[model samples]
Target: MARITIIETGHVPRKYRERHGSFPDMFARMVRAADPQSTFDIVSIPDGDALPDPRQVQAILITGAAAGVYDGLDWIAPLEEFVRTAHANRTPMVGVCFGHQLIAQALGGTVRKSDKGWGIGRHVYQVTPNNGVVAGEQLAVACSHQDQVIEAPGDARTILSSDFTPHAGLLYANGTTLSVQPHPEFDADFAHVCCELREGSAPDAVVATAKASLAEPLDSAKLGAAITRFLTRR
Candidate 1:
């Protein structure tokens, strides 16, 4: 069984927490569906939990966060440093959404709130052939973020792309590090609720479209399996 450490940087809303659980919990469920024997250890940065040594971890997954990569939070810098150290050690690592942007910024990439606006709900991405992670032409998954990786790292390859999110998924040259801007851990129910939460913050039309997009089937399970395979592969 592979022991994966999940770095939790955000929290679910109080009302939704009871039904959807925490981000790490969702990820555990998603990963276990693909690898039944996989075990997990969660380190919540927002809860004041210290980061574990990357060299000691079998694999590391950074969860999505409400905070932006350029927010200048006290913990943000340390976490970026952690990502750098972990990548240097060639530790198998995957990052989602905010985690994706964090990893990109930590490397040589640029991240910022895009003028293209928010990308919520179910978004489809064109998968690059022979990516070695996902095996498909297109991948549709949940997304909820305004910030994006404006510029990819020098050594990163665009494994997943869409017109809205050009750098949706990045596979580093290290071969052990990967990051995606979508959330395969989020179920339709949770995704819908996320759209509802954005009603006031996001434009009415965008929220409506996002909520409606959830009516279509999502390929979250497929992506989860791919992520599990990536992390557990020898």
Candidate 2:
């Protein structure tokens, strides 16, 4: 079985963690979908220095974080360096929300807090026609983020989008790397909890109504197959 080293850079802060749970639930599901047999050692480097080297790993999955990529954090520069080197060396890399932003920032692109409302719940992401990453497939994915990639990291191509999120997903021209802004790992219950903690209401009538239209459960199997396709190459 192949091993995946997941570097989790996102958390809701300790004061908030008791209410939110200690993990990003959605990424776990996607990893499950990727390969149930695949085991993972999660390295949560909130401080960033504790971050591990990906060179020894089979794959690197950067989990979503609540932090903005542009914040003057101590670890941003080093992590950005790690990503560029990983890509350059042909190590397969996958970025989620904050992870997506970091990758973009490192590769001559940018990330900014969207003036738009924080997208929560399952959002439908439209796959561009014949995108090799999406393979011409669309997914009703889950998301909870306020910042996004405004442009592709240098030498990257857009593969999926929605009217709300332009950089919903991207693939490096190297074809070995890809990322999804909307989470494939979110189950309804966990996603609802995230909404509850972040927005103070998940089952709220208005919120539920919004999520009703957006939150379609994507099969874990489908996402796993897609991840497998992504990692098998670079």
Candidate 3:
């Protein structure tokens, strides 16, 4: 069995929690779908759970957050340090959305609220050739973020790309770290709700487009399986 520790940096709103579940719950479900024997441990930072030593965990997964990587929250610095420590220890790590940006920023990349506006709903990314982490040539996944990793870390390679999010997925030189700007754990219903939540914050047209995109199929299962494989690979 593969033991994965999930660092929960954010929460699903109270209104949606009952139906959509928390970020860790979503991830656990996704991972279990791919590897039924996989087990999980959730460490919620917002709940004041202290970060764990990276070396002690078999693998680490950082979940998406509503907070930006550069938000300067008290927990941000420590979380970044944790990511750095985990990377240095060569712990197999996977990050999604905010987690992706956080990992990049901690490793000397640039993250900022993009002028390109919010990338909500479903977006397709082209997988770079021979990127061993994710199979196939393209991936369509749910996304909800304004912040982006504009500049990737020096030791990172762009494995997934789209016109909107050029640095959609990054694979670190260390070979044990991987991150993606989209949410593979998000099901279509949850993704639609995420779009609804952006009704006022995002442009009406963008929100509508995002909501419409959800009517189509998403490649979430494919990516989820890939993540599970990455985390459990020997």
* Candidate 3: stretches off by over 4 Å: none
Q: Which candidate has the highest lDDT of all?
A: 1
Q: Rate the local accuracy (lDDT) of all candidates.
A: 0.95, 0.72, 0.95
For candidate 1, the 10 contiguous residues with the lowest summed lDDT are: 11-20
Query: Candidates 2 and 3: which is better by lDDT?
Result: 3
Give the lDDT ranking, best first.
Answer: 1, 3, 2
All-Cα superposition RMSD per candidate: 0.6, 3.3, 0.6
Worst 10 residues of 2 by lDDT: 197-206
Model 1 pairs in collision: none
lDDT of 3 by residue, 1-234 (tens): 899999999999999999889999999999999999999999999999999999899999999998988879999999999999999999999999999999999999999999999999999999998988888899899999999999999999999999999999999999999999999999999999999999999999999999999998999999999999999887
Q: What is the TM-score of each candidate against the true structure?
A: 0.99, 0.85, 0.99
**Model 1: how far is 31 from its true place, Å?**
0.2
| Cα lDDT for residue 201, candidate 1 | 86
lDDT score, residue 51, model 2?
Answer: 63
The clash tally of candidate 3 reads: 0
lDDT tens digits, residues 111-139, model 2? 89877757777777777877765554577
